[model samples]
Target: MMSSSPESRIASLGLTLPSGATPLANYVPYRKSGHLVFVSGQLPKEVKEDGSAFFHQGKLGESCTVEEGQAAAKACGLNMIAQVDKLKRPAEVISRR
Candidate 1:
C-alpha cells in the first residue's frame, strides 16, 4: 500500500531525508527521519539571480512587520526549491541510493 504521508512518497522516490540544520547557539534549521523532512527557525534567504540563498536577519515585530516576516519565510522556501532544482538529475541521485 502507498503511504498517505507526503514524506513517505518523497522517500519512496529515493531521496534520503535531510537532517535538521542544528545551530551552534540555540537555533535550528530542519529535521528528518527516513524519508520525512522538517524545517524550522529560518530567516529570509536572499537569492541572487545566480541562485544563491543568503540569510538576511531582521527582527520581525520590531524591524519588520508580520507580513514581512511571512515573506521572508516564503523566500527561504523558494531558495530551497531552487537548490533542489539545480541537482543534476533525479536518475543521478536516486540511482545512487
Candidate 2:
C-alpha cells in the first residue's frame, strides 16, 4: 500500500492553510541565509470575513486549558507549513531526526 503524502495527511486531519500567512508585525515570516532558512513568530491566527485577524490568546498553564493549547499549537504548525510552502520548499524538510 502506498503511504499517504503530507498534503493528504493534512487533509485527512481536516486542517487547511490559513487564508493569510503573513506575520502580524513588521518582521518577515522567514529568512534564508546560505543553506539554512530561519523561521520565527508564527502564531495561531485566522483572517475573518471582514478582513480582520483573530489571534489565539492566553498563555499555556495559565489561562489556557490543555486542549486549547493543543489546538493553538496545531494552528501554529499549519501556519508554519504555510510559510514553508510560500518559500517553495517541501514540509518534509522538517523531520523527526
Top candidate when judged by lDDT against the true structure: 2
TM-score of each: 0.36, 0.73
Cα lDDT, model 1, residue 48: 57
Point out the worst 10-residue segment of candidate 2 by lDDT.
Answer: 88-97
Please give the TM-score that candidate 1 achieves against the real structure.
Answer: 0.36
Per-residue lDDT for 1-97 in model 2, tens only?
Answer: 8898677988898877775465568998888776666778778776667978777889899998888888787878887787776666543454332
Q: List the residue pairs that clash in candidate 1.
A: 20-30
Error of 2 at 80 (Å): 0.6
**Per-residue alpha-carbon lDDT of candidate 1 for residues 4-75, written as tens digits (9 for 90 to 100):** 654565557664333333355764354444554444443355655585656656799898888888867666
lDDT for model 2 comes to: 0.74
Total clashing pairs for each candidate: 1, 0
Clashing pairs in 2: none
